[model samples]
Target: MNNKLSLKNINVKYGESLALKSINLDIYKGEFVVLLGSSGAGKSTLLRTINQLNPLTSGELDFFDLGKIRNKKDLQNLRKKTGMIFQQHQLIERNTVFQNVLTGRLGFHSLLRSILPLPKFDQELALDCIDRVNLLDKALVKVKELSGGQQQRVGIARALAQNPSLILADEPIASLDPKTSHQVLSMLKDICKKDNISALTSLHQVDFAKEYGDRIIGLSHGKIVFNGKSDQLSDEILKNIYSSSTITEETNFTSNEVVMV
Candidate 1:
């Protein structure tokens, strides 16, 4: 199968500290892949490297039909085609839901054009995205007025407005309660399946990862220790992934600040 995103011998460094080491990963069309790891295990770093948010120390990134990401223009095109969902919801609290979602379409317009009123098509698309997440009624409401789950749904709609071929969700549900997390993940998975968009999501909850992920990847100290179907993620592997970290079988932990890739 053709990959939506491919990373080969990827490495990322923050100054002298290495965050990702010779990592290799691939995401295919419509695939829902969950990333599991303890804090500082490199899940976030790996995701950021794919869209060039974290500059690679050495590696090659190939995006669907876009060839290798080797230059500034390639990076720009990659960003336009990719959608990102963050843990904090990342919405403008003062802006209406529709307004926040509309920002996703700005990538397609020139800088000057983005500042002006968006075309009718973009406006309609933003509404459609809101509807996709069952937030049509909340479109006119300020983002701050919504519940945590609703705010995350708005974030999903914003990403959907990009009409992306691939989505990268970095701990998208870390802040919500268990019930709300389930609702958000269910909505996100259903939407991606229906749209046939590939997704890579990071999570601390093992149960949720097993439930929602078609495939699961385990990260340990900046390296991938396991990558397989969810059913194949045995307990032995889980121990190896979180052994030295604070994460436990029953614990759902959260850490780190997130950014769009």
Candidate 2:
């Protein structure tokens, strides 16, 4: 597989507190990489930093095709090719499903162009994305009218509309029930595989990670505890990754902390 991203000695800090420390990792094209950790494990920070949402305190990120993300133009270009799926879905409640998904293409347009009606190709892509997530029937319905699962599926459709080479999902199923979480995750995994897009998803459920991840990365107190294939995640490793030390002192030590290698 091609190397989609490379993080070399990555570090991120919020004020004086360190969030991610000395992180070194690489994600390959078409791989579904699952991140497992507690609430303050910096999973969200890591995902955000990839798109330059969170500025790195010190590190070198080599994104595929774009090389190093060094300037404003490179950052903009990186974001244009990267899609983000949030835990809350982040859709405009008053907007229709189609409108919500169509916004994903905004990254590809100029400010003036975004204010205008999207091109026909973008409209068609939005419809295709909606269909892929089985929400074509709900496309015209207001976002507020959809169920939580349906709304999350719309988030998936919006990300799909980006035609992104990579998708970053931060706790995508956090607010979902068990059954709905499975449905959403299964759909996401299938889509990534079918479309050959790389994905980095943070999930709290260890079982779900093992089930859906091509590879699993476990974080603890701003450090990587484990990086291995799903089946290689032994019981002992899980214990180490979710050790009590991470929750008590480390959790309160700083609001953000975690890393990968």
Candidate 3:
């Protein structure tokens, strides 16, 4: 349970508004952690900051033994170790599944090497990644031809091809149906366990976070409101994390019942 990533008193701001408060987090290797909160709780912001996609305004952020990566070169190397999966499934619609997965090799290849088609070994690696996601049969199919769930699986394959030590997923299952969401998340959990890689996923659903995460960190108003084992989250903690007005508007619904006179 060695720490793979550590954030100490991290803070982020955009102009006058603060995006993240003094947040401290430690992610151990081979652990599955979930950041849970309503929208705008800084879950996405925190994830981006880990990869240095969003710069920290204050405090220390460290990834493994890479040291403090302040320059572009160091940041680029950090990104190689941290792979990101977005909700949109950010694949090139025109590219074949194999081609999309091959893009993950860019971090390992030279600029000139990546400009051309991937090398034979890289191609085999991409295919292996596809097999890991159970999508080897769709390797030749265009990205646009796949369903939403299939596309997200392809995204996972792409991350696998990167040979990442840590994977960050930003609401990866947000766009899928409930059944598909469960399927994709289950696969993601399996992949993380199988690869022995650490994973941090941001999720809007408390139930999914409880089910899939070994640990859950709840954010509220840009601060870490709760951090503990998934089984430890209480109803009171959930209410506090989701107390915003938006949550009431989005999650409040009741099924209609028929009345016979």
Candidate 4:
């Protein structure tokens, strides 16, 4: 895998409080990397900094064409190539599923065209994205009418419609039931692999990270505690990562799932 995104000594802060501390990492093309940690561990903060959603207080964040984007235009272009998925589906509840998916093309469409109405090609692309997520039947449905899982699928399709080279998913399955979570994660993994796109997903479920990620990174208190292959993640390392005293076998979420050999 070739390096597609790089961050060096990256630090993020909200006013006086620091969110990430001296972060350094490289994300390669077509790699499914997961950020794992408990709440307030800064996993989401680190992921957001990649797409410049949270400005770095210090250090370098470099993308493919924009390099180190400090200007608005450069940041806009950088965002166009990077897709983002949030915990909440973030869909327009009043809009049709097709219209919500078409929002992804706003980056590519001119302001006038997007504001007026989606063009014919844009409509086709939106439909194609909806079909890719297996939601072709829901295209005409209102976003408010869908289940949490279905709405998230819409979110994924929206991101896919952007044709991004890199995807940043912040707790994509955090809101779903166990079965729904499994389905969504499986879909995300399949999409990334099939499309040959890179993804960085922040997950609260350690077992889910182990099962779905090509590489696993564990963070605690804004610092990386573990960075290695998923198979190398022993209980000892996981304890250190979570800083927990009680580590239970029953807590293992991926033990019954298929492990990627």
Candidate 5:
């Protein structure tokens, strides 16, 4: 299978903190990989690096046709090839869902074209993306007026608008309730499958990870403790992935602080 992404000797640092330590990984096309770790195991940092949002102290990333990062222009285009879903649904709350989804196409247009109203076909495309997330009816609604779950769905639509081959979701369902979390993740996986988009989603909910992911990577203090099929992530393996020195499986699920756990 074609690799969706590949990293070799990857390392990231923020001042004195070592966020990633010589991490290496390869994700195959159309596969869903779940990233799990305690509060500081570097899940978010790794995702940020994939999009060139976080500076890598040392590493080489190969994102298929996007190529290696050598300059600002290269990184900018690389971002266009990938979509990111953040914990906070980072939307223009005041804008209607259609406008927000249209933002995904900005990378494909010039600054002037981006700021101006999108063409009719673009509007129809945005509506189609919204419909994929089951929010077609809410397309005209102002984003701020929507529920938290709906807002997150809009984020997914915006990412879809990018027409990205790979989607990196950082705690996409963290803020949602258990039932809603399942709904959101199921929708995410289903869309990726139908669209043939590969996804690397960070999640704390172990059961959800198993149910939704084709593979799992468990991290601890910027290092991978396990990288295998989700079924291989036994309770004992989970315990190792979230050791007390990092994050234990017993860590509070409600707290983002359990990032490494």
Candidate 6:
């Protein structure tokens, strides 16, 4: 199968520290892949690397049909083709849910168009995305008025409004309760399946990843320790991924990640 995003020997460094080491990954259309690892294992770096939010130290990157992104237009096109969901809701607390969702379309708008009011069709698209996340009831309400889970739903809707073919989510549910986390992740996976959008999500909960992902990629010490189907994950494999054992350190790290590659 042709991949939507391909990375070859990808490496990322934060100052002198290596965040990602010699990573090779390929994601097919509509696959929900989970990334698993303790904090500092480079899950965040991997996700950021996909959208060029984190520059590669050295590597080849490609988006299907778009080829290697070597120019500004290519990079801009990449951004427009991919969506992002942050760990926190990252919504403008004062903005209404619908308004926040509209921000997702700014990449496609001219500067003047962005500053001016959005067109009627764009407004309708934002409303549809909001409805996709079951947030239509809160469309006119300020983001601050919603619960934590609701705010995260708004974030998802914002990404949907971008109409992206790929989504990069960095531990998007790290702050929610167990029930809420499951609900949010389920909604995200369902949307991806329905839209045939490839999703690369970093998550902390192993069980949740198993339930939602078509495949799982586990990292340790900034290197891939395991990459296979979710059902293929064994405790021994997780042990290898989490590494030579640092319990307290792992406790401080983030959530699970699943991807279909």
lDDT of each structure?
0.88, 0.88, 0.86, 0.85, 0.85, 0.87
Candidate 3 yields a Cα-based lDDT of: 0.86
Clashes per model (N, Cα, C within 3 A): 0, 1, 0, 0, 10, 14
Local accuracy of candidate 3 as per-residue lDDT tens digits, 1-261? 335788889999989889999999898888999998777889999999998888889988777767666788878888988888999999999999999999998988889978998889889999999998999999999999999999999999999898888999999998998899999999999989998889999987777888889999989889999999977887667767765533442342221111111
Model 3, C-alpha of 38: deviation from truth (Å): 1.1
lDDT string, candidate 2, 1-261, tens digits = 336789999999999888998899999888999998776778999999999889999989999878898999999988988999999999999999999999999999999999999999999999999999999999999999999999999999999998888999999998999899999999999999999889999987777888889999988777788999988887567657776343333232111223221
TM-score of 5: 0.92
**lDDT, residue 196, candidate 1:** 93
Worst 10 residues of 6 by lDDT: 252-261
In angstroms, the error of model 3 at 194 is: 1.3
TM-score versus the correct structure, for each prediction = 0.93, 0.92, 0.92, 0.91, 0.92, 0.92
Q: Please list the residue runs of candidate 4 whose C-alpha ends up more than 4 Å from where it truly belongs after superposition.
A: 1-3, 244-261
Candidate 5 ranges beyond 4 A from true positions: 244-261
Candidate 3 ranges beyond 4 A from true positions: 246-261
Best by TM-score: 1
lDDT head-to-head 3 vs 6, winner = 6
Residue runs of model 1 more than 4 Å from their true location after superposition? 246-261
Question: Can you write out model 6's per-residue Cα lDDT over 120-176, one digit (the tens) per residue?
Answer: 988999999999999899999999999999999999999998989898899899899
List candidate 6 segments past 4 Å from native.
1-3, 244-261
Candidate 4's C-alpha lDDT?
Answer: 0.85
lDDT by residue (tens digit), candidate 4, 128-162: 99999899999999999999999999999999988
